[model samples]
Target chain A: MNALLTSAVAGLTAAGAYALLGVCAVFTFRLVAVVNFTGAAIGTAGTFSMIGFISLGVPLWPAVVLGILVGTLAGALIGLVMTQWFSEATATTKAAVTAALLVGIVALGLRLTGGQSPKEFPTLFPGSAFRLAGVEVTVASVLTVVLALVFTLLADAFLNRTRTGLHLRALSERPMAAELLGVRVRILALLVWAVTGAFTTFALMIIAPQRSPDFMSLSLLVVPALAAALVGAFRSFPLALAGGLTIGIVEGMSSAIDGISQYRGILPFFVILAVLLWSQRGARWDEAR
Target chain B: MTRTLDVSGLVINRAGLPVVRGVSLSAQKGQISVLLGANGAGKTTLLEGLSGIIPTSGGDIALNGRSVIAARAGERARAGLSHVEQGRTVFRQLSTEENLLVGMAPGADLADAYDLFPELLNRRGVRAGLLSGGEQQMLVIARSLLTRPEVILIDEMSAGLAPVVVQRLMAAVRRLADAGLAILLVEQFAALALRIADHAYVMRRGELVYDGLPQPLLADPDRLHHLYLGDVQAA
Candidate 1:
């Protein structure tokens, strides 16, 4: 029973990071109508930059800030390309553009990192564990869960209770109608991109220390994040966060079963396939949007 | 009569082929100027070009005596030019009150909209997509009114609606015109549009074939039939 409780606490810590990534994906998808595939790669790049700055004898905190700024600029750059070059493109075309950007960013990150080997990631949290109900929990784990909940509440308030949030909700529903109604869509899209980029960096910063940090593994974390966002239909932030937590807990629990221990990595794919099949049943192919 | 919306020699080209050729028209405040035509007659295209949704090859569009040819769609909207597009495309995911808030200009009040469309007041919290077709139409028009526009260009306001609902919508539109808003209405129902129109224009194959008072076009059925069905004998 203690073992099971330990695994659950560990899973919750990981779930907080996954929830952050899922929230970013859902937010960008809602505002811009594109599933941004480059988020993890951008986060990976930001992490490498922070490490590089540390290697150069820069202070740890400032280096992290600089790295987040780089990620934010990368996101803004993607927004600039989307709004300036492909503003008139269809939803499929815009999504394809994001896919292409994902490939480009991954390649750039691998080149900059010099190799795909795992590197030791430094943690900002103090190494301390406390006993709770006969289960040991790390300070970082508590911090992660608390920060995730706070961010979620703040995001919900910003989206529902503010004027800009109302405009964003309107744009997500019908972009052309929103434009005709005098909403500055392009500017708002750029802001969403910047926010998503910064959030991605923050998620990676908290989560990367738990595993071996590498370009390939860190960037591929988007797959599970994407599955979580898909569970929300890329609309509801709270649902996406809950989906991410559920996925993390399920994955953690499945590892205890001997029969399914080897297939842990394939769980997210099954969730995605199940969701797609269920949502598309009896739905028209041409009814995308 | 002071002109609220004035257009002269407006030309629109789609893929190098002219869709609206040298169209000229003027709308006065407190009146409805109806554009009557069949499908593919370029009525919708002309309105799109005027509202800056599509590029115009050559034209001058003046709103309240100020030229707005260089403005984009949002800029035109800010300049008091409101467009209620075809099919009444409301933000389906937003509530009726939220939709009205989106269209409201700075410092504008929602009480005016609620006063104008009382039915919408009762369903303000409901999602716009869940509303009935007639209610959706009323919501879109009510949202546009929140902008306090000087001129409104509405396309196919009565599409796929019951006759009684259409009558109610038309009565609301007449009230708007009576309240001194210039209205440019495009419709396929010639008889229905002529009843409320002070001036009317008929288009055939992207060109204005007739421009005069609605009484003459309503009196001569053969001319109206030829303009729409391309057969004078069908009248």
Candidate 2:
């Protein structure tokens, strides 16, 4: 029992990462109207680039920054494509484009990154732990939690308070009307993609060290993130963040058990299914919510 | 020099068919130019083309004696063209003041809108979607007005509103014309729109069927009815 509790507590780092990624997913959905399945893959482009740079004898911090830039650029490129060709597309169409792009990105990422090969993932906060409720807690876990909370608060304030932020919100709600009112629609959309890209890469950077997982597995982390987003209906940021943490805790507890430990990665799929079924409980096929 | 908003030989296509063809018109400063048309006469498409909401296949739209046909919707708006789009396209999630601020250029005052519609003063913090139909109309018009536009293209200002509300809105539009702002208004209430309009243009089958003083159209309802009835018979 204590081992399960310890494993759940240790899962806080993954929880923080999942929460941050979920927050980014929700942000893009609300602001840019894309479900963005390519989020983790875009970050993996940076993550792999950072790994490559580190292997090439580059210093740690510079390589990480370069990796983040790569991710940001990839995100901006996707935004540009969406705005240029599919600006008026329905939400379903936009989501379809993202899902297609996700497959493309992952295939390209696997080829570019060393497929089926292991890489060393050095911990950012190695050997850093503190006693919390008789269990030693890592600083990385605390930092992830704090980062998710602070970033969410900051984003909420930005979207609600600032002038440009107001324009962004207006653009998301009414694109045609907003453009007629002189709001720069494309620029704000690119900004959203770039910012979320930076956040996703940063989140992956903190948690990647704990498990030196392969590129394909790392890129697929967008699933859990999306599951978290589904919990919030992709609208409520706080709810998505909480859903991410809970998912992580559940996965961790399951990992400690004998029967379900191997199938822990499939847990997010179940959460998404449950959320979809619950949301559609009382509605008919045509009027399904 | 008073800058006028004018379009010449404009053609617009929708779904492979020309909805508006060879249309020429102009809105002079300090005068209301009302475009009257029946339900499928392409009045909305003409207004949308002039505002650059949709693409214009052919034509030249000029503002301040310069061609703005190449400018997109955002560019045209920044170049002093404000469009109060159909169905009260106010940002529903935004507060009244925020919607007003969207059109507001930097360092400009917001009192111009409130002075025009003082009812918006108390509803400043309320979300625009929560407002009544009349209030939403006021908010959309106020939003367009805050841009300090030299010319405003209003689409169906009397759509789905009470007669009292329509009267109030027309009065405000008249006040706007009096302030030397070039006005192009599209309204379903032909009698009310003609009451204040200096010039009136009626559309039929994607072409301008009548272009003259509003007095003539108001005096002869049979002619206007015949023009409106032409399409109904054809269809």
Candidate 3:
């Protein structure tokens, strides 16, 4: 049906954003051992900064570059604080710091924007739609899907083929052993944080135009993203992407149904709970801790 | 004799309680210095302090005649110190080849590691976690060997290994020492370690109580037993 095809395209667009965010979240968690609750806020800040620069008459490309740079620096600052300033802090304390950072960055973004009102986010992609198999498909939607695939492939290659990527994987597996083997834990941690920060921003740039580019909504997008990461057990990139797409499709399909559509937002919670329960069923006490 | 590693007046405190106190020793090139002690005697703690895994409260560590007391664990490793920690601590998720790559110095070939442990060569593509205990030990040792370290601090190398595997590892370690690398070994198997050790020190409750050639201690079981068990009657 045309309705089914339209929803599928819409689902793919949403899936691209969710998959990017999920990959970033999972990568950061594996490398730094922190959940990085501030990821969405950092992306939201970058998106707003790009829009502000565009309004100030800066060229779109340069403004976009500056926004990404700002996001990267912000991520590095957070990493420095966590790895250097609070290196000896417990895992619980470090996680609490990330939560606090989420609040702080969101507040800072609100102050910078002067209000929580929605701003028109710009898109670099051309505004065009084409009829495909009797359903309308936007160019942005197709571009987003392509970009997601390309980024995933690039990320996968970097992790599997590069030397620094091996070091990252080593650190994720056994940090003490990796350190003893001469992996620079601090520098690598900073790099992971910076990359994820920039990546989250890039993903937001694509997704922001599709939603209201406001502080709360943009920041809360991390909820579904996290659900996707949890679905992958915070390790597998391909699985995380698949999980994101599946969630997006389910959400899109649910909206077409009658009575249950009101509870669409609660979908992530159910997915998170189910996945966690299933995964934890075999986990020993020591491992679960 | 050239001293490769020297730790003098070393003291380490964990949570305000001294774990390694006033321990001093030196390892010479082409010799194996074994630190023998019972559980909780701080042999592992002393090895950790030397490798910069744990901070030393007081004293100095000079590696190749340079003070490395202020250097971190990774820095010390890059400066030619390697620690094979207690237990088989490989990157379980990484392939055996990739695990070796972690210790491969730039421009150095992994051929030496593979040559030293042929089993690793056979299972190069497999994840290290799937390897048996002895194989994992071989992988860990081979990985460290690829670093071409001047001094190696190995802790409990024989732990959880079969007797035959322990003998094989000891032979490999002896070969390494014969090749002019200083080896500081911490072992729970005191008798087995003494067979391969040149110099020996006994630790009790964080302090060294006996320091002598292994031959004298090995000749006098009563003294060695007293040192390990605290009293002759206890022995």
Give me the candidate number with maximum TM-score: 2
Candidate 3 structure quality by residue, lDDT tens digits, A1-289: 6666667667666777777788788888887788878888888888888897899999999999998988888888899988876655666888799999888888887787876888888876756568778776677666665665676687788889999999888887777788888889889989988988898888788888887678878988888889988988888878887887778778766766678777877888898999988977777665877
lDDT of 2 at B223: 78
lDDT of 1 by residue, B1-235 (tens): 9899999999999999999998989888999999988899899999999888888999799999999999988889889888899998988988899999986898778998888789999899999999999999999998989888888899999999999998888888888999999999998778888889988988766778777899888888778978776654311
Query: How are the candidates ranked when ordered by lDDT, highest leading?
Result: 2, 3, 1
lDDT of each: 0.84, 0.88, 0.85
List candidate 2 segments past 4 Å from native: A282-289, B1-3, B231-235
Interface RMSD of 2: 0.8
By the TM-score metric, which is better: model 1 or model 2? 2
lDDT of 2 by residue, B1-235 (tens): 3649978999999999999999998999999999998898899999899988889999899998899999989899988898998899888999999999976876557898999999999999999999999999999998888888889999998889999999999999999999999999988899999999999998987988888899977997887888776733321
Clashing pairs in 3: none
Q: Model 3: what is its DockQ?
A: 0.72
With candidate 1 superimposed using the best TM-score fit, by how many Å does residue B102's alpha carbon deviate from the native? Answer: 1.4
Which rank order by TM-score, best down to worst? 2, 3, 1
Worst 10 residues of 2 chain B by lDDT: B226-235
lDDT of 1 at A160: 85
What is the alpha-carbon lDDT for the whole of candidate 2?
0.88
TM-score of each: 0.90, 0.95, 0.93
Greater-lDDT candidate between 2 and 3: 2
The CA lDDT at B199 in model 3 is 91
